[model samples]
Target: MSSSEPRPESGPTVPSVLTWGTWAAVVLVAAQLVLGILMLSGSWSLIEAHAGLGYAGTLAAVLAAVSAVVWKRRGGSAGVMAHAVAMPVLMIIQIGLGSAGVKWVHVVLGVLILIGLIGLPMSLRSARRQSL
Candidate 1:
């Protein structure tokens, strides 16, 4: 460990947790969207499953956000951290809207959350590359 020697790069710390968590959240949101469509078409039986998956998706989003914070502490981008943190917040609001019977707003917010989840991995990758 001489001063003149280059240290080994700690590439993309927490990539698996952050990236996979985001992907899981994305998949859950997509499934929820399908369930929502079915419910709108009068398939009320799927509502319980939809509600269950919403909580799971929110948990996954929270995991992603926490991992992003860990990544930032390990020298990742602040922007990426902020982006990851937004997902769970959006999920909570979306859940509230759904619980309050505000169908239209809930659906729109769900779509936006899905879009954000889809973008999370790309942001993580970009931050990793920048760090390297």
Candidate 2:
């Protein structure tokens, strides 16, 4: 290799803009949780707001999962992709319970979804670093 010759390009220096999907999922889910808690505590209100945001998070999760799958096919990690898919599935169950007013299970699933949302992004970041 001579100084005048072009060198091969290095790997990604910046993360993908697709990360917004992960962040959107996390933020929407967190907001939904807060809304649910407020409704339960009888202080804050808006069941409709919670439901709407819950659905938004649900869609975001699916989108994020798709992004992860694409990323994985491109030689990224599966853990993050798995988590992205898992969260929405769990959230849907939570929503169903809430819709049917199956109190206890709905609350339980909400807790799990919150945990998943938090963990998914963290796992993704770690996996991305390892891939890099």
lDDT of 2 at 107: 80
Give each prediction's root-mean-square deviation over alpha carbons.
3.4, 4.3
Residue-level lDDT tens digits of model 1 in 1-132: 674433465434545888888999999989999999999999999999999999999999999899889878876678888999999999999999999999899988988888888888888777666545
Worst lDDT 10-window in candidate 2: 6-15
The residue-by-residue lDDT of candidate 2 on 27-57, one tens digit each, is 9988888888888889545889988998998
Per-candidate clash tally: 0, 0
Q: List the residue pairs that clash in candidate 1.
A: none
Off by over 4 Å in 2: 1-18, 43-45
Colliding pairs, model 2: none
Q: Candidate 2: deviation at residue 18, Å?
A: 4.3
- Alpha-carbon error at 116 in model 2, in Å? 1.0
